[model samples]
Target: MMLSCKEATRLMSMQMDRELSMGERLQLALHLTACAGCRNFRKQIGFLRTVTRKFGDQIDDS
Candidate 1:
């Protein structure tokens, strides 16, 4: 079954928190291959994760 953009994006978000099963990874990859918008979203989120990881501790939590 094809994953919709919403589902794929949710999986993408989940991936940042923990490991996904092989099936979930495959579905997200398949969705990203066909959906440019989601692909861009994937990149943006990836970038955000990287940035936060590098700077998250530097920011003061209020």
Candidate 2:
């Protein structure tokens, strides 16, 4: 079954916190292939995560 945008976005967020099942990964990938908005959201979240991690690392080094 195909995932809705809401489900796809939730899965994307959840992935950052934990490992997704193979089925969830496949479903999210399929939805991302067709949904530009969700794709953008994924990219934005990824960017934010990277930036946050870098900032935290800098603070830790201080």
Model 2 ranges off by over 4 Å: 56-62
Model 1 alpha-carbon miss at residue 58, Å: 7.2
lDDT of 2 by residue, 1-62 (tens): 99999999999999999999999999999999999999999999999989988996677644
What shift in Å separates residue 36 of candidate 2 from its native position after superposition? 0.6
The 10 consecutive residues of candidate 2 with the worst lDDT sum are: 53-62
Give the winner by lDDT. Answer: 2
TM-score computed on alpha carbons, candidate 2? 0.82
> What's the TM-score of each model vs. the native?
0.78, 0.82
Q: Which ten residues in a row have the lowest lDDT in candidate 1?
A: 53-62
- For model 1 the local lDDT of residue 16 reads 84
Q: What TM-score should be assigned to candidate 1?
A: 0.78
